[model samples]
Target chain A: MKCNAETIGLMHKYLDGDITTEEEQQLKYHLEDCEACQEHFRELKRTLTLIQSAERFEAPANFTANVMKNLPTEKKQVKYLRWFKMHPMLTAAAVFFILMFTGVFFTWEQDNQLVVSKQENLIIEGDTVIVPEGEVVEGDLLVKNGNLIINGTVDGNVTLVNGKLIDDDPLDNRGLMASVGEINGEFESVDQTFDWILYKLKGFAKKVFSFE
Target chain B: MEQIIREKIILVKKGDQSAYEDLVSFYQNKIYQHCYRMLGNAHEAEDIAQEAFIRAYVNIHSFDEKRKFSSWLYRIATNLSIDRLRKRKPDYFLDAEVKGTDGLDMYSQLQSEGASLVEEVENNELQRYIHTKISELPPKYRSIIILRYLEEFSLKEISEILDIPIGTVKTRIHRGREALRKRLRHV
Candidate 1:
């Protein structure tokens, strides 16, 4: 290629030892007869040399000390987090135990529900028991559960072990009954004549026990 | 040496204050010089250099060990200097022509040390003139020129430091050289 201003600029790169050998040879051949380009190259080289040789400024002696002094304090929380990162399994195990204990504490009451099968003749042990309808229970009834549903007829005295007794007929007592736990919820009956008595009993129970 | 610096950086990341100080000491001069050239003011350069070290320390955990710490430090210093420069003079446009005696004023602001007395008097003016010309270039072009010529960073390293593509770095270097050459020809 013939010498031109752009070629001379490229020659500046050549002078800086930045160009490929082929490009360097091409520029050298072009500059062999190009006096103006050579002069421009010379001036560019001189300017680049001046820039390259400029002295670097040194930081003040206390720069590092000053920077350290001004640094924000190392956060204790971050140090703890770094420690946790280094022992991931330990962190995970701690988290797991915390969650496990919380789960057990929160669900302790709800997990106390008991289901009594119709075929069993034994006393069910739980906080709540469901006694299905159309069964005849002959023995003294004792419900230790927090809630009791007795649709069957009882031949002996009915006793609420730790909770309220719920019957369809509140006044048709074949025997007397007693409760040791708070009574909750309304009792609905099939017989309409006892409804007023049930209402009066429920109102009395509400006033007497503050049942919710 | 690089491995030692990397180990120190890891220590800094782990909250070793002494290690952080060592890292700052290693880079303070180089970063201060880079900021001084970019900002054209010694006081601002020192402030920016300190700020860069502080920022690097604060965000050291985010630094990837695979990259060069010097390049990362340079990037922080360059960004801080540019931000300060932009804030100091809201009306100063990098692409605007060098007007009035602002160029000479900037030349006067250039400071050098450790040069022999003979060389200082003779070459100081010429050196300041060239540095002033460089300072006249836009921050973007000025940075590429400084990284390429002064800091002697490779184009790839410049790309990584500035977070730009290598092609853009090459283009900026070319345009910066052309602008400098045009200004020098006038002188």
Candidate 2:
């Protein structure tokens, strides 16, 4: 077999002892007859051998130290970076500050005014004065002879009708009117035709003390 | 034997810099040689190898003791070398080509001294030529070749080091060696 570039290429496998016996025989036969191919094989082998036997150059005396010096004392930086990387809360806090600063700078000129209107305005002409759940009543809630159902929260005191002032909540103190023909009773409730007085002789005692 | 490596690894995890240094010293030569072959420059190879050790020391905490320490070290060294190679695009290919020419011409000048020159200058020229040819290869092929031929690591070790299948290592080594041979034909 004549040796060309392709056949010569197979000599690599031959030199590395990678080719099987049959290919080896074929390459050997080709090498025996061809001077150029044999020279090429010798040159290749010689080069590989030289490279293998060549004394490897060493790094300079201060090489390791120089590398260490250039390496940014990465121990401390890496420790800090790793700590920050592992601690998501710290990273989140940093990100939050950054975002806040960025947002303030970007939106500094935007209008952020908050307007508050007058809270309370109501009128009760007949049966129903309806208000939403959270609406606040600013002035006194006055009622005359009709039952008042307060669905919304009252901001001020409520006055009731018929001299029979009523309050369902135990925390409320229903102040009674003084006896002068001006709605006068001691916060009394007519319970089964009997009077239940809430604040009785306390005022009488106060009057006795004033007698001096 | 493997159990001893595991214990050393445990000590390393406990922040034993001496244990880590032992590990570094053990593999540093092979790693340096591998990097040197890959980078084709002594200074860069030393820097890369040292960096690899530092990284290995810091990240020893993350290593699985079940695996070979040498494999892990090789992986770090290989990665660092590849990264450095990527960042280094020769700013002057023309200048590099000129340098190559100058080297060949200098060797040829020494060749005028006859058969003795053949022993010294020819051998040096061939060795330098082999280095240049190998350096021309792509990083992947270059790595396998350097690890296989120059470092003379076992195919199994090379596979583990590069985190590749052995068959892939074999294929790359075959291709790379053949490529080097082909390129050096002109030398």
Candidate 3:
């Protein structure tokens, strides 16, 4: 028997068990006649059988336990990412609050308009604010980009930024002189802006995270 | 068995450590045998097989539930074996026990079909010889031959495990068999 390419190919397919019945018949016919191809197929089978019947190694008894023990602990950042993936709504809400806070904070910082605390009892005239005489200012008063006239008793500290302090009598019983920040130029304004941003962010954090 | 594997997979995906332990425990011997054949060293086989399980657990989220878990696992073990083979220094396998087949008891290896004791001993020696030859083959042929013969994986499954086309798998199997045959015939 010639045992040409087709016979050899058929033999391989038959050995691998991938041939159809029709092709199987053709290979069976060929192997019956071809002595050389039969010897070749026998060696292949011998090799495969020796390999299949070879000795095997088993894992150590502690393999699974060791695997479980050696598993890398999930990093905090990965847990946060997975948590955020599970809760997109909360992630979006956090992102929204952050953007809004950033926008409002910077805009308020850049604004040159007068910003005063405890506006109820204070008298405003143009850029000057006067705490009326005998009026008790309840809490700390903050004046920015304005003139502050001290006439009444302020129970808390007075913080003045980008403003002037005018004492009516320049005498006793006035509000205690606290830290004063006078914005002289752009550098001073930037410094005041950072301080104001920090103050607002601190208060905002308290309000928001207090629930948490 | 399939139900147990599925249940363990679900539990493992849900971050249950014991479930993962059960899963690894189920496949450990098979995986260790695979690594041992690919690497031809017990210590490296144990290390690489354990590494494969740890990797599978760490990447559990990326694993699709629809595929065969064993195939995924064998892929990891195969790749780790390949990496280790690539990084191996010459003479590293000198310490590997090529005659390690003696570790198995002959009585336990006896087949139900009666065969002469002399023939059984010769066959055992031949199998051990072939095993050593297999470990010496290049990584590419060694892996495909092991998948085809020892593991009895179909060509499609081997293709999936090696991430190659079925045609490539068939060609490699053919050539791998030829290489082993030539060396075998010389002896």
Candidate 4:
């Protein structure tokens, strides 16, 4: 309704072509009787024009060369930094695995002790036996608490009381009564042999290590 | 021109030093002028402009190709200039009112008839006087004025470069123009 400095300011915006239609109408209505505000708006426009037309300063002749010369040597380290930033989860997982493996490696001696003790028990039990091919046996063979595989020729009777007998030639019997192999003695199945041996080893280990 | 700049930027990212040099040469004057207008000192402008380019080079890999390279460079130069200004004038306040001179002084100065637009353009003194007055404004307002007028950045571009909201950019532009007009009314 009334004209003021703000009206003149709006008039400045209007001169800049930055005012909305409503503001334009308001400034036009105010300016119809406001000759002083009109002159102020004219001066503001001139000031803006003067500033916009100010000459820009030129850069120094060697500005680019100086910038290039002062640049830090491009460190390849930025590549790794960017990679880690890009794949944060992957980097964290890799770091975690590396730390875990390092911890395991550092404590490997203690773990090896436990493994060595278990291996000693297995050796004492002797549950697995290997027979190489092309070897010959001349005397009676007796195996207990183990599997006996025959890949070689045998000249004597074989008896397995607490183990399994595996022979490739089933009809190679020479002196004993056998359907698949020669046997001079009685063969018996000991189904509970492994359980029995494991129980005994547990008892022995508890005694040796004083485990509660 | 934009396509060529993008291609050169890609090469720079791949460690092509020559391409990097070309980019520096292309943008040196533009950046220098922006810094000079914002800073009002030739030596400081050159130093800060050089620093801005070096920083851009070091961080080139992180630059997104979707944005214009010139905008990015201007942003760097602006930020550097603002930092230098703040460090140099630790007590400067952007929102502080112009002291001592109420609206009357500006009105009186405006009334004292100065040279016409044609005469001011013909002479370099008016230009230098306007430049000095712009430099005398608070760094925040001066920066916006330079970006808007000298750099010819749009309101949205100024927002992006200054990392401010478009509303804030518009408000600052209005206030900055007002401040400059008050200062240049006498000249």
User: Which segments of candidate 3 are over 4 A away from where they belong?
Assistant: A1-4, A20-22, A74-212, B91-124, B185-187
DockQ of all candidate complexes = 0.33, 0.12, 0.35, 0.33
For model 2, the stretches where C-alpha displacement exceeds 4 angstroms are: A1-10, A14-18, A33-37, A59-212, B1-7, B61-66, B89-133, B165-171, B182-187
| lDDT of candidate 3 over B65-152, digit per residue (tens) | 7788999999999999999998877764433443335554334334321354366666566666778888878889899999889888
Q: Each candidate's interface RMSD, rounded to one decimal? A: 2.7, 4.8, 3.3, 3.2
Q: iRMSD (Å) of candidate 4? A: 3.2
lDDT of 3 at B15: 71
Sort all candidates by DockQ, best to worst.
Answer: 3, 1, 4, 2
RMSD of each: 15.9, 20.0, 12.8, 17.7
**Residue B181, candidate 3: alpha-carbon lDDT:** 79
For all candidates in order, the CA lDDT equals 0.72, 0.62, 0.77, 0.71
Candidate 1: stretches off by over 4 Å: A1-9, A12-21, A75-212, B90-123, B185-187
Model 4 misplaced stretches (Cα beyond 4 Å)? A12-18, A74-212, B89-123
- Share of the reference A-B contacts seen in candidate 1: 0.55
Each model's number of backbone clashes?
Answer: 1, 0, 0, 1
Question: On residues A1-212, what C-alpha lDDT tens digit does candidate 3 reach at each position?
Answer: 45566776776677777889999888778778878878888887776766676666679888888888899764466467667978999999999889977886777768689888754788889989887776767667777888777666666667766677765555544344322222222212223666767766776789988976
> Can you give the TM-score per candidate against the true fold?
0.56, 0.47, 0.56, 0.56
Q: Write the per-residue lDDT of candidate 1 for residues B21-138, one digit (tens) a residue.
A: 8888888889999998999867778889999999999898889998899999999999998898889867655444433344543333332332343566675776777777888899
